[model samples]
Target: MTEDFVNGAAVQALLDRASGLDAEGGDGRLKAIVRELAEAVMRTIVRHDVSESEFWAAIQYFQEGAAEFGLIVPGVGLEHFMDLLMDARDAEAGRTGGTPRTIEGPLYVAGAPLVEGDVNLSDDPDDTGTLYMSGVIRGPGGEPVEGAILHVWHANSQGWYSHFDPTGEQTPFNNRRRIRIGSDGRYSFHSKMPNGYSVPPGGATDRLMRALGRHGNRPAHVHFFVEAPGYRTLTTQINFGDDPFAADDFAFATREGLLPVPNRQGDAATIVFDFELQKAGASTEEGFSLRARAAV
Candidate 1:
């Protein structure tokens, strides 16, 4: 009972701080979310009038659960959270340009191998899927940004990433590639398209979902992280040409504008994606680059 009362004080302190907030620094919108989270935490904590020791034991899962997650997927959630807020913030400030930013999964590791043009991503001898991704990276004027960098990667048939998949041979950047945008902001690569994946079978997300009797599955898609100087970075994906589960993506990562038209062929073929970005400061930074960003 004493412990519960102390927890109540903690809750009130949080509420007090959150309720008195500013839009820019204090973020009034965050107060409601804090309230909801506080209530949830209280619900789990106040259930049995447990002893102080028991309460600590119950709270241990927060750290354990977090440690179970990888670096990539966690950022996906953060990306989504930021995207929602930034969209409103940008609109309020009248900043615009480029396709809307989306989440970048934790699977994105830096320092991929660079190449001039086409990349053969399928490493398995038995694997025979071909996909060609081409595009122009453009600036605010809708003009091409020459020498932009396009880094790409995708899962194998088993829906596993290169660094994580145990079934595949131990090779670094197996399904990854980096391409330089040509004089006209044009870039292209060749690889086997990706398939969708389900959540980790028995983690906190899945444990909660299973207790709530929900299914955990995500739709098929390929991932990309494109970078350029004087422009923000673009971390997005393209769903399989005709994935039935695209709209109902388990992760709910699929967006209408995020989907691209895929051109499949028995023979080698290609499709073009026109990428664009607004001038920095003139618009909110959408696709950030380190080489120039650090210089600024």
Candidate 2:
């Protein structure tokens, strides 16, 4: 009798049986991906000799963290990974010369007050360090992109985002707004410099970070989602150049050419960052998934 070999080859063969109905109308990609991932996971488990107890514990850990899944993606770099994949595809297809796109994280709300060229975003009375940030939205060749919408939001000094915090509901949209680009493609806003963010202490995210010897902190940064006619929507963030975690962001989202040094002008610190957008080419509908959109 042959000795049993419990490596992934045997497990994968067993799993592949479920993919037998290849002619069932659907493209075979679904079963193919499932089989591939299942095999890889089995390999990792066997290679590491993960015990059944450890696997079940991991499952329970994930279940507990499901509510805060949005926060975990950026923390673990999945959000950034997706952005990199999109960027690579765009570059391979000849899409270039746009402000680098970054992760959107999970806190974006659809309806924000639309303001004109410039407005004050911070509502906290104690926020004494004002930030006067402005920028221009232009096309690939620097042509003005009038009427572009800049949906912006950022964490407050205490690292809590408006609307997500319990008290934040009282002033639902504070520190978050949608600004329309002016005729000259200029948009500006005054707010306090947002402080950095960290994972909830003692939560599922924190547990994993601790196990991996990693810290769950993001550098101080602001989020922007720019959309306009004839342009691909741009999602990106700008980080403070001097933040200790600016280069060591847990999300791995910090990008070169995006870190801006704040210049002090009297009471306010100003950072200028202009955005250049790529022209919309063929529709990116092929790789689009509604479920994935809902996840973000």
Candidate 3:
């Protein structure tokens, strides 16, 4: 039987100091959270009987894999947990049902050119099949949500996104755009059919997933950010129903009403999906979180 020292006085004092519980200069709420987190970590260490070498190795892993943390977060389902938490909170507040929110993967770039009505997202000359996607944005009451901006982005057939592709072959903003909704709240775009992609082979995220006996792969999907006045900003994406990984997305982003089957016709495909928005209650819900993103 392993002796538990996590709750002992000496350990408690160490946790308190580590979390700055005795300091009055920092935020009270933050300090409280830190103390709780530190205690929880201590409990885990004691429960697992983690060796000092193992602990240091884990720290070194994080230090070496810091660049892949964004992917790791989703791959390990932390991002999805956040979505579930938000959903539960909304349900508790009686703010139920429009469209389910999902994890916004860390590949979004800022400052896409805004266009009115319809637009073309695939400006590059690629051999991939053409895709025609159209959608309407509506409120909970089924009324059109005018003045909305629909931001869309996706990877190309080679499973490479602009601004992040290592081949240096993609133009800036290759498959990204922002379409402003007209009075009818309709938005549409034409682009190359995106392909499903796996995490970079041999990278930190891929290595971690392999060690966990899991595969880091996402289905062919289109990302969206729909925002309108008086409505909560929606960050979501739709996976292609035909993709093999649609039901097994590593990012856990697939949701009901978000998987649209593509209608195939020769070298072209068509997808029609509608989106519904919930009314915003707080000002913070009116937009996306301010995070560092690629800009050109």
Candidate 4:
């Protein structure tokens, strides 16, 4: 609207301020891409027959999208980006070709019962299943990671995880548990295993997917996240055998070694699962369990 300045050139200046980004000694990757796109926006506005207010409205919409940034995997794509970086590291290091990494969905909560060698996978989980998931956790060198802890959880019957189901009576951290491997390198737990369902279909993730005409369903699977003092954090899932999309998870979570075999034939009545982790940082004389860290 000013005499000397036109409609589009003024907006281009807002993005030009990012030109010195690489000189600041940081990753110039994202900033440079943003600047190029900003120039394109200005050119588009100058060429189109669109009104001035319409161009301003487009900017307003992008502002809204940025303001709505979130932690959900389906939102910013950071979760997937982090996974790719981690997998690359794993490949370079040639550690244990371990389990498949999966999304930690917004539902994973900290703190669960610190039990010994076995868990009962019932709502009132008290030894309901017959099979116990027993195994030894070993470092990348095949040495036992004695005293390390493994956290485990799965959905209750009807495929509902706690804290996410308004209709269910389960508590906030419903089928979750934290167990340390014994000095002998053995660990075990009992729980009715889980089956996966759709990602929350009405949330922002699903809304965006529906707008793209994508299905919001995640295939049947089990979630696992494990950590110990000297090992990298592992987040993964074990998918059931029947899903056609097992190789093509919408979450991109399904990985090799995470898909458990059909032992009980998909029955929640029993699951005898076991896993070993690759070593991470320096092994310290200092003891570490999640509970010990929390007590500090």
* Model 2: per-residue Cα lDDT over 168-257, one tens digit each: 442666688889787799998998768887888898788788889999998888988888877777888898888899999888879987
Q: What C-alpha lDDT does candidate 4 achieve relative to the native structure?
A: 0.60
| Model 1 bad stretches (over 4 Å) | 1-63, 70-79, 123-126, 168-170, 266-271, 282-296
Model 4: clashing residue pairs? 119-190, 121-191, 121-192
**Considering only N, C-alpha and C atoms within 3 Å, which residue pairs clash in candidate 2?**
none
Give the root-mean-square deviation of each candidate in angstroms. 6.5, 3.4, 1.3, 6.7
The worst-scoring run of ten residues by lDDT in candidate 1 lies at: 287-296
> Lowest summed lDDT over 10 consecutive residues: which window, candidate 2?
287-296
| True lDDT of residue 156, candidate 3 | 96
Error of 4 at 51 (Å): 10
**lDDT at 203 for candidate 2?**
83
TM-score versus the correct structure, for each prediction: 0.73, 0.89, 0.96, 0.68
Q: Pick the candidate with the highest TM-score.
A: 3
Q: What is candidate 1's lDDT per residue for 59-174, written digit by digit as tens?
A: 67556677445422432354466667877897898977677666556566566677776567665542546667777788888888876888777776567777767675636676
lDDT of 3 by residue, 247-271 (tens): 9999899988889999999989899
Worst 10 residues of 4 by lDDT: 287-296
**Model 2 stretches with alpha carbons more than 4 Å out:** 1-10, 17-27, 167-170, 265-267, 283-296
Candidates sorted on TM-score, descending = 3, 2, 1, 4
lDDT of 4 by residue, 1-296 (tens): 33223335555566666554435665587778877876666556656756879878756655654422332354445666767787787688674465556566555556776777655544454222333456667666667776677777777655677765667577666677777777776777666655556655566556656766776666666666667676766666666655666765666666666665545633333344556675665554122223211110
Name the better of 1 and 2 by lDDT: 2
* Steric clash pairs (candidate 1): 22-26, 72-106, 73-106, 196-220, 232-287, 232-288, 233-287, 233-288
Candidate 3: minimum summed lDDT over ten consecutive residues — where?
1-10
